[model samples]
Target: MQQIAIAQAAEGMVLAKDVETGDNRILCGKGTALSAAIIERFRRMDISHITVEGHPVVEEGAKSLKEELLDVENRFSKVRHIKPLLYLKKRIQERLIASRRPQPAAKSEGS
Candidate 1:
């Protein structure tokens, strides 16, 4: 069986490695960042017969991932409507105080 290296692997490409019989395939398999997405797609396609090797290039790709995650967090915070609750509470308190106060009567023209 031939051993495939991750550096030579590309997304959407099938691995040329082979698994041995009675071996724990999942434990033996290591993957790269390119391989992770490809593996996911392969899983979705029900193609799980190939063996993979190498750790994901997560450290190498961390900057892009961090930026994407930050963007998602910012978008979620914006869509959560948290500020609207505070504004509504303040407006309600103001209205309640206004309702509790006594209004002054208008002066008569003759007086």
Candidate 2:
């Protein structure tokens, strides 16, 4: 799931989490596919951000996974000799790869 600014949201994106009101009431449940009207309603409700089901929105100039992993490697190079630090670096890389994996799109989500 990815939390993104509501301005960046568009129609057809599925919600990964519930959108709640200020009083903790669910305005929209998870798996709700966004539509123009719903988005507009959210705007009027003062909602700033929401969690979407997948990494569907791509920003310009975002780094690829290879570049990101290389950056992690470079930063951890100095501590590669330290056993604990090396393990931590490995775990971080694992999580990055896991997060970047494609999620299966829901075909009947909105239906």
Candidate 3:
């Protein structure tokens, strides 16, 4: 299954394939809806810089989904912020990679 790298992801974009293990342990799956609720929350918070998930961070010209999300999540909220989202994305990717790793029969069975 091919998926756009997080750097290439954007808001309102649907994942193309299921991010899962050969044994079908899903880390992040295809057809997962972008968190539109978060967008609305930001809008309510008076944040105009909206970022979607899985997009590259551009410095200036135009903000990507991640960038916009970061700006709002970081600038407005004292609790939720860009770091958490980044961490979540990273953990998901790591799980996907780990799920793909070849494991011994014992490990596989345990999993």
- Error (Å) of candidate 2 at residue 71 is 1.3
lDDT of 1: 0.40
Q: Count the backbone clashes (under 3 Å) in each candidate.
A: 1, 0, 5
lDDT of 3: 0.43
What residue pairs are clashing in model 3? 9-54, 9-55, 11-52, 51-65, 52-65
Off by over 4 Å in 2: 35-37, 106-111
Residue 93, candidate 1: C-alpha displacement in angstroms: 0.8
Shift in Å, residue 24, candidate 3: 4.4
Ranking by TM-score: 2, 3, 1
Could you tell me the lDDT of residue 3 within candidate 2? 85
- Winner by TM-score: 2
Task: Residues 2-94, candidate 3: write the lDDT tens digits.
Answer: 234344344445443444444766544444443445334334544333222233243448544455455554654554557877676556555
TM-score of each: 0.24, 0.68, 0.25
- In TM-score terms, candidate 2 sits at 0.68
Report the C-alpha lDDT of model 2 over 1-111, residue by residue, as the tens digit.
678999988887878889999999999888788888889989999999999875777777988789889999999989967999999999999987866665554432345
Sort every candidate by lDDT, greatest first: 2, 3, 1
Which stretch of 10 consecutive residues in model 1 shows the poorest summed lDDT?
A: 102-111
Better of 1 and 3 by TM-score: 3
RMSD (CA, Å), each prediction: 29.0, 3.0, 16.6
lDDT of each: 0.40, 0.83, 0.43
Question: Relative to the unseen true structure, what is the C-alpha lDDT of residue 102 in candidate 1, on a scale of 0 to 100?
Answer: 32
